[model samples]
Each structure stands twice: as structure tokens, then as C-alpha cells.
Target: MSSILSGTPIVYFECRQCKCVLQNPTPDVLDEWKKEHQGHTVTETRKYPLFDLGYNDLKKAGELAQIANELGAVIADIRFMPHTRNPEFSLKHLQEVLGDKYIHVGELGNANYKGTGGIQLANTEAGMRILHGLLANSAVIIICACWKRSECHRVYVAKEYEKRYNVDSTPITRTSARDLLSSVEEKNNPQLALW
Candidate 1:
């Protein structure tokens, strides 16, 4: 054998990718690293996480609202058009989930299906002030909407915060209520999947 064997070695006895003739890590070394990693763990915990309640269907609102409550989030309902005629727009379930923290702020007009008007409204100076106030009190602000995160005006609002406040304002998007619920459940039940 040469003094230096540098290449992707095919043998299991040798390191696979390193450009050296080093032997493969022994099982003892691997176990020691695993034990060290397990003992010295570092986890980041966020005080508050913004939740966007993006459910247009009233049938599922109650379920999503419960999940949001379990996750400890505030709900925001954005209605551009007057919801006087729409009983579903009352969002009673969401209000119950958020309690006094529920806030509804938007212009009175026809629903901006294209969402351009909503984006503009959220990007205005007044809009920035309201968002700033929300951020001041809470570490995260949850935007409850009837659409996905990328398509919702809440994303625009987050970006506006990033621009005006010069802060990291990336909002987490929950496309599926089931997904969020499952994730929260997993966090609570650590033994469910542990070997």
C-alpha cells in the first residue's frame, strides 16, 4: 500500500469519502460520539410562534381553532368585505380559541380575490404600526386567513415588518391542520417513536 491512498474507497474497512487512508470509525468510537451527543444536547425554544389560521371552510374552523389553542397562538381574521350577511364570517370558534386576543382589522370593501389590494393595505404605514404593536407584546403574531401562507396577505405583512422594523419576520405556514396537530402531538409524546 502507498503512503497516501486518496480516493473514494470501495472497501468497508476504509473511510468512504475522505481523501486519506484512514480506517473506518470503530463501533466504540461511534457509540461514544452518540452518547456524547445525547448527553450534551442543545435545543432552541421559541417563546411565541405566529399561527396563520387559513381556513375558509367553516366546517373545519372549529377543529383548526382547537389546534391553534393547543399550540398557544393568537388568531386573526382578515375580512375586507363586510361580513354582515355571512354568518360563517363571525368565526365564533376561532374567537373562542383566541379569546380576547382575537383581532379583526381590514378595510371595508369587496373581497379582493386577486389579493393585490390586501397586500397594499398591509404594506401601508398604518398597517406597519399595527403589526409593530402586535410584535411588541408577543414574540410571534399568528395570521388567520383563508389561504395558504405564500398566497396570503399575511406573508406580505411579514415582509413589511422585515422591511420597516429590520427584523426577522418569517412566518410559519400551516397548510394542513392535521399536519400541525400531528406535529404538536409528537412533541408532547416523545416515547411514541423512540427506539
Candidate 2:
């Protein structure tokens, strides 16, 4: 039998006899552990939805908040430089709009965002740790500036997250945003649904 371990980093697995402790082990590592400890059971303790969205798609901070609220997720700003010409997207204003539900994980940001070198993580481990902490509580919606997921660095971030956490990221499309917004509107004004 495996003994439970607790700490700030959150232990994912522990073997008392072998003194093998895995902290935040990736899916592959967990699989290997299962094979090594044939009789031991490994169960996924928690699963939180992960999503990627572009602020351009939502256009307004309020809409972003609304979408996050609908999904019961925290907004993770993954922009290396979380500033924009658009006042609403600027870090301070976005934080103001999102309040406690917003967090800027700059470490996950692409340092070469402006260069042709492609996405480069600023601090992969640190960023992942922060995201892991958040995942323990609620779903996470990673946001970036680019409108297209294919052309955005957030895609790379989402990929990295999937690799580290073994979770698939759902790309929030424009249609989905519109539908969520429409739902919010209808909920706010029940009469709107009749039209």
C-alpha cells in the first residue's frame, strides 16, 4: 500500500517501502509507477477543465469575465507583456475587471513573442506550478492576444500544459463566445429569449 504525503507542492504519489515519492508526476511517470507497483492503485484525484481563448475573440474584459463565470474558471493571462493599446486588455484594467478570478502567469508566456523564433517559455516549471495550484481549485482559461489559436503562443502554452498535466485544452471559439454571451444576456433579461 502507498502512503499519503502532503505538502505545498502537493505529492502525487508515494511509496513508503521504496521511498519513492513523485511530486506532480506527469502522466507518463504515473504510468511507469503503476507498472512498477503492479498491485498499487493510482487514481486521478481531481480533474479541472482547461481552456484557451483570445481576448480579441471576446473583445471586452466584461465578456471574458462573463465567460469565465459561466464556466466557473479562473482567467490566466499568459501574455509575456500583458499590456495593450486597448485599455480594456491592459493588465491593470483587466485585473480590475476580473478581480480575484484573474491571474497573470508571465512565466508561461512566450519570451520571443515579438520575434520570429516562435514560442519560448519564460520559466516552464514555475509557470506550470502556478497553474497546477490554480487547477487544484477551479478550471482555468488561458488567454492571449491573438485571435487565431493556430497563430497564437497560447497554443504552445496549452500544449505544454497538456504535456505536464495530462489534460486536454479546449479552444474557445468565436461561436462559443457568442453563444455564451447570448446565454448571459438571456439569463439577465428572460424576455430576450422570446425574441
TM-score of each: 0.51, 0.77
Cα deviation at 66, candidate 2, in Å, is 0.6
lDDT of each: 0.47, 0.82
Residue-wise C-alpha lDDT for candidate 1, range 1-195, written one tens digit per residue: 122111121122222233223234468865554455553432322223333444552345455555545545445555554243434446564465556666665521124545555444533566556655654444334444445666666666566567665555434434345555555566679775463
**Which pairs clash in the backbone of model 2?**
none
| Candidate 2 off by > 4 Å | 1-44
Worst 10 residues of 1 by lDDT: 1-10
Encode model 2's per-residue lDDT on 66-148: one tens digit a residue. Answer: 98887788999999999899999999998899999999999999999889987888999999899888988878889998988
| Residue clash pairs of candidate 1 | 51-142, 52-143, 53-144, 53-145, 54-145
Number of the predicted model whose TM-score against the real structure is largest:
2
Q: Residue 53 CA error for candidate 2 (Å)? A: 0.5
Mind sharing the TM-score for model 2?
0.77
Q: Model 1's lDDT to the true fold?
A: 0.47
